[model samples]
Target chain A: MYDFSADIADCAQAVEAALDAYLVPDRLSGPGPAAIRIIDAMRHGSLKGGKRLRPLLVRQAAAVFGVAPGQALTAGLAVEAIHCYSLIHDDLPAMDDDDLRRGRPTVHKAFDEATAILAGDALLTHAFALLADPACHPDPSVRIGLVTELALGSGVGGMVGGQMRDIEGEAGGFSGNDIAIMQAMKTGALIRASVRMGALLGKADPEALAALTLYAEAAGRAFQLADDILDVVATPEAMGKATGKDAAMGKQTRVSQLGLDGARAELDATIAEAIAALTPFGPPAEALRATARFFATRQS
Target chain B: MYDFSADIADCAQAVEAALDAYLVPDRLSGPGPAAIRIIDAMRHGSLKGGKRLRPLLVRQAAAVFGVAPGQALTAGLAVEAIHCYSLIHDDLPAMDDDDLRRGRPTVHKAFDEATAILAGDALLTHAFALLADPACHPDPSVRIGLVTELALGSGVGGMVGGQMRDIEGEAGGFSGNDIAIMQAMKTGALIRASVRMGALLGKADPEALAALTLYAEAAGRAFQLADDILDVVATPEAMGKATGKDAAMGKQTRVSQLGLDGARAELDATIAEAIAALTPFGPPAEALRATARFFATRQS
Candidate 1:
């Protein structure tokens, strides 16, 4: 079994450092006060603590392709910024209507709703700006690839699309297949982009991209299953956010569809599939496989 | 002196043709139903009839720089998409809460609030995708420049930022300087970008770019002042949308600050300044100058 306690901790620390440096106050200079506030709000959402799972996936995939860990920091930062923006918007009054996020007041709850909306908009727009910065990457092709990956992943066909389905699926019962589709998009898309971007940054070959994608998909599913189980079984204090809200809202979840035991079984199978997909990637993939196991079984 | 009816008719036709091509059954092929609905809603908002002023500015600026008109269409489409997205979001219940737009129900009123929000998100994301397409411009540098222009013009530093300030200024009194800053971003930024992108597409010199920026700034201010004048003088039927809503909402306006006659004088001076700025670009800039004149005095 992979030991995530140490490795994932290191990855999380690296992500935090990179994000702080990336979103430094100097980077947002020259814009007017309105623009500055938007940037500040984006930083507020992005710099807040999370597990940094997406950025970690990016770093590990880059490692598998022989990229130095430090060199992957910029790509990892860009992906995290996009993820952060999505979360800010998803928690808005018109969307998910959540007041707390990651154990603290959400951006909208901290700022006004309009400011939060604009902050999310600015963050999404700025993610592309960062990726397109030629100074950030030596290869133009890589920058283009990164932009395309991010656009497709967070755009209508990816995360946002998945979110729309999740909202739509709330009113009606969704099939297991439908639930899978939503999970793949609402959560899986960004996770998948993390690995794909890491491979592209490291100049990985076709085989490596395919393998990493499979690994990310399995890991993503396991993570969602774990979230579903936690939503039902964990307390708000333990989970750091509201629990059982999804079920109360009549949203379809693994626990609702598969029951607690079946959901736990599915999580185990997904963790195994994730690990199996990483077999061809060898030792560099060890950390990622361990991360998946940790995601599947974590209490919070 | 300028006849805008003919130009508006032609631009509307162009927009419709392009949108019809975009919305054909084939373009709707996607994984999820929610994605399809969001895209449909986006197309519905974006393709609807309007003056197409931004695209025309792009085309006219390109002509001034001697580039083929065809080169302006895609950029024109991209700008319109951004503009429409902004309008949709601005008209949301949390924002402007308008029921009618351009003689039709607003996107949020036509669809549900959630779909309207998602549609705006989809259009904004897709605008970059359209600009970045290889087919849109073979030169990577050109594509990058367009992306930068569009992103900056739409972000907090540009239109969205301006909208935020507009809201704030209305709720809380602003100084003249604050009003100018908001106008520069809210209206002037995209107008400046429309001309700048046109010049870039035409590969115009730095001198020409500078001239176009000046012209666009003056014209954009003139346009907004004319809008202020119209809101007081024109009826709802004549305006094709709700008028006088600004005053009702206690929003700041040129007329409010400078009086009606003073605002009219400012509009005239702004139009003259726009015309004078174009003198450096010679006769080819006449159409652009004429467009500005039309904006100042047009009934709609």
Candidate 2:
């Protein structure tokens, strides 16, 4: 009965606007040409449309606790900027070496490798600045907490660490458990932060925080499993990037480990668990519950 | 009549210890082996000794306001970590491509290029986290201020932007004024943050803040000029790395722009200006004045 698609669209538009406001390429402020180049790369990498799933999750979670849409939107944009940066870096020649992202030339391919690297670095740093700004939260503690959570999710202990493992796995062998932990770090950590940040901004009690965290963890796993399934089952045209790149690279994805059927089964189970975790909030959490269900079935 | 050599050494030790505490490679927390590898690279890049000039400047600035040594040291370490991260990235093949740093293999040389990149990213992220932590400052506003200052100093419009220009300048030709602006961003921004963060933690008044800002700007420019002079004159044995790199690459530096004698004159003038800026602080700023003098003349 509850649909998140419209809400997702609205949040994505707001986040895009916020990102534009945050990233005006000021030639007078520093090195003119260089600043333009990096800012262009940043905009190129970030502004192209995607699912905007993370920001939507932030909004949906916030909506559950009556947090201001504007406040939730700021946190969402910060997290999205970080996500955009990670994608840019991940597409670098030394990294995944992908030339296309979101149906266009990747940051490195569009600009240059050095610019891409610097753009990624800038975006990551700017994310913290956004969180730290007074506009993000009234209470400094909440702002500090946002910064801390984002750093933990996106830094060495989370996304970067998982990226390292993922790269290593290309050579490779990894147990399912090892892969699971890597997925948790690489994808789940940020997703968890995206969901929980809205809750934190809303000043959710400890019990609600724990429950939402569990829900986010389940939803994150489901999302990854669905991604693995799509990598094998979907066409490159449908996905907007190369499909089966994971298989080509010998990546030990869930689909490879558990097979398509098992992976789908796992995704369904996780989605069910995610929905169950929202029982405390009951009807008010319908949007979040709908988001969890959608994650396991999202086509592109 | 005050010498700050002992004070510098004491501050350096404290900063090093704090860096170690902040960068513990906890395998159980994230992607274990990959985390260890990146942490190793981070430690390798950061732990090996240098002059600790930035942290020392922070401490000296804080001392003027009687800020607690521990609080100053924490802020100092955060700035130092950013410095270390910059060095690691600058030494990458896509950037400066230096093999040795401070007489040891650069991070990319010690580890792989990917690990070096990730390590730099981790350190940069961790720096903001350090600034945002309550341990860094009891006041959340001060912590947020540190985060904002650092983000501005190190992001696209600051150090990274400056580095972009520096990299582009390799094919060669930048005006004297252009080099000055670039140098301010490339090196001076973080240095300014170092001085300002200490004073900020100490809650310096607006007038004092302005004076220290001027002093830091002059000192930073002077320090870079000294480095340029050293690059031309100091032996690799003394400098702990290859000398004449700027000349060999046809890179424009203060020395290249102004000639050796002229560069030295500028350094002297900047040092004098730095000292004059501290006239308001009087004897409380003795160590800072000594530091500015040291910047103009320190050898490898």
* Winning candidate number (DockQ): 2
Off by over 4 Å in 1: A1-7, A10-26, A29-36, B1-8, B23-34
Q: Please give the interface root mean square deviation for model 2, in Å.
A: 3.2
- Give lDDT: candidate 2, residue A37: 67
Docking quality tier of model 1: acceptable
Best by lDDT: 2
The residue ranges of model 2 lying beyond 4 angstroms of the native Cα positions read A26-34, B27-34
Mind giving the per-residue lDDT tens digits that candidate 2 earns over A128-188? 8788778888898898888888888887778888887777666567865888888888898
DockQ of each: 0.41, 0.54
lDDT of 1 by residue, A1-300 (tens): 646787678878888877677554455321333455666677778875788888888878888877877777777777888888888888888888999887888998887787787777776776776776775467766776777777777777778888877877875668759888888888888888888888899888888788888998898889889999999999999876899998898888888888899999999998999999999988878777778888877888
Give, for candidate 1 chain B, the lowest lDDT window spanning 10 residues: B25-34
- TM-score (all chains, Cα) for each model: 0.92, 0.96
Ten-residue segment with the worst summed lDDT in candidate 2 chain B? B26-35
lDDT of 2 at A245: 86
Q: After superposition, how far is residue B22 of candidate 2 from its true place, in Å?
A: 2.7
CAPRI quality of model 2: medium
